[model samples]
Target: MGIVNVTPDSFSDGGRYTDVDAAVEHGMALRRAGADIVDIGGESTRPGAERVDAATETTRVVPVITALAAAGVPISIDTTRATVAAAALEAGATVINDVSGGLADPAMAGVARDAGCPWVLMHWRGHSRDMNKLAVYHDVVAEVRAELLERVDDAVGAGVDPRQIILDPGLGFAKNAEHNWQLTRRLDVFVDLGFPVLFAASRKTYLGRLLADAEGRPRPVDEREAATLATSVLAVAAGAWGVRVHDVRSTADALAVWRASGSPRLKTREN
Candidate 1:
């Protein structure tokens, strides 16, 4: 998946694609670069970010989704609200990537089931406003895995087919820098839930912290492309079914190199 943030405040490359035409053009570019899906977001869920009203979000995303659908590009609506998902699916989005994991809005799972489209459920605690305080975790891997498993059950209970569901570990969302690192370290844990895993660490602050110089100042999001690509390659090697990223061409190219080697199961460093 390639990311197209149609909001002014997404953590990375937010304002670059906010324009409708530009968003469509960027989606096409990503498709050409080998993105299996283009995820378009109208709301910025970055930590402490404000929420955009449903109408505003719908307005921002619909045009782009409609254009991309017409262009025959697979599109996923990255939203937590059921209303937005419904609107986007009707507008031609084929998938719903909900960071809230069916928590933010009660009506989302139903929407996904009704649409009969694939849904990507991300592990989430609270909304971005107070999520930092909620980042506390014990045995981060087991806890996240267990929580996501429960979410899978909930989604199934809500009539979402288990087969149509994909799980994401919710990187950078409700996770501290250290927690994010732990999740990265245990990226394969989510795959045990018997669902495909979507790894979305593109330009997150964790990468910035990892690549910081001795001065300890974090690198800017835009300056973390190398780290981002490296992390994506690592995640793919760790059994990720998909990766959500801002730089599609580079990631696509990197994955191509891995694919040419037969893209078999990833071996651990120890192996």
Candidate 2:
């Protein structure tokens, strides 16, 4: 999956693709770069980011999704609002990657159920504005797995098809750098849940912190692609179904090399 943030305040690549034409072209570029799915998000969920109105989000993403769909590209609506998901699906999105895991909007499950589309349920503690304060966790891995399972139960109970459900650990959403690394190291715990897991650690702050300079300053966003690629390769090697990345081509190339290396453990199941 490749990320297309059509907002002005996303942590990375925000204003870069806010224009409709630019967003659509970037989605096409991602497709050419070997992204299996293009995830279009209108709202900025970066920590401490303010919320955009539903209408605004819908307006920002629908046209881009429509244009991409018209071009026969696989599109995923990255939103927590059911209304936005509904509009994007009507515009040609076949997947809903909800960061709130159905907790943000009560109607999200119904939208996914009715559309029969894949829904990505990410582990989220709260909205981005105050998410950083909610990162406190005892056992990060076990807690995240249990919380994700609870989300799965809720989504299933709400009539979403279990087969269409995908789980995301939501690295850097409300997690500290240590928590993020722990989740990455124990990805199999999520994969073992019998649902396809999406590892979205692309250009996240935690990666930058991990690759901090000698002075302890975090690496810049553009400079973190190497760390992102490492995370993608390791995540896939550990059985992640897919990775949401900013540098799709580099990650794709790395995955191709891993596959060509003839590692049986890298074999993945179709979703």
- Per-residue CA lDDT of candidate 2, range 1-271, in tens? 9999999998888899999999999999999999999999999999999999999999999999999999999999999999999999999999999999999998999999999999999999999999999999999999999999999999899898999999999999889999998888888888988999999999999878888999999999989998899889989998989999998899999999999998766434334
Q: Which candidate is the best by lDDT?
A: 2
lDDT of each structure? 0.89, 0.93
Candidate RMSDs in Å, in order, are: 1.7, 3.0
Give the winner by TM-score. Answer: 2
The residue-level lDDT of candidate 2 at 142 comes to 93
Clashing pairs in 1: none
- Candidate 2's displacement at residue 73, Å, is 0.5
| lDDT digits (tens) for residues 20-42 of candidate 1 | 98999999999999899999999
Clashes of 2: 0
Write down the worst ten-residue block by lDDT for model 1.
Answer: 262-271
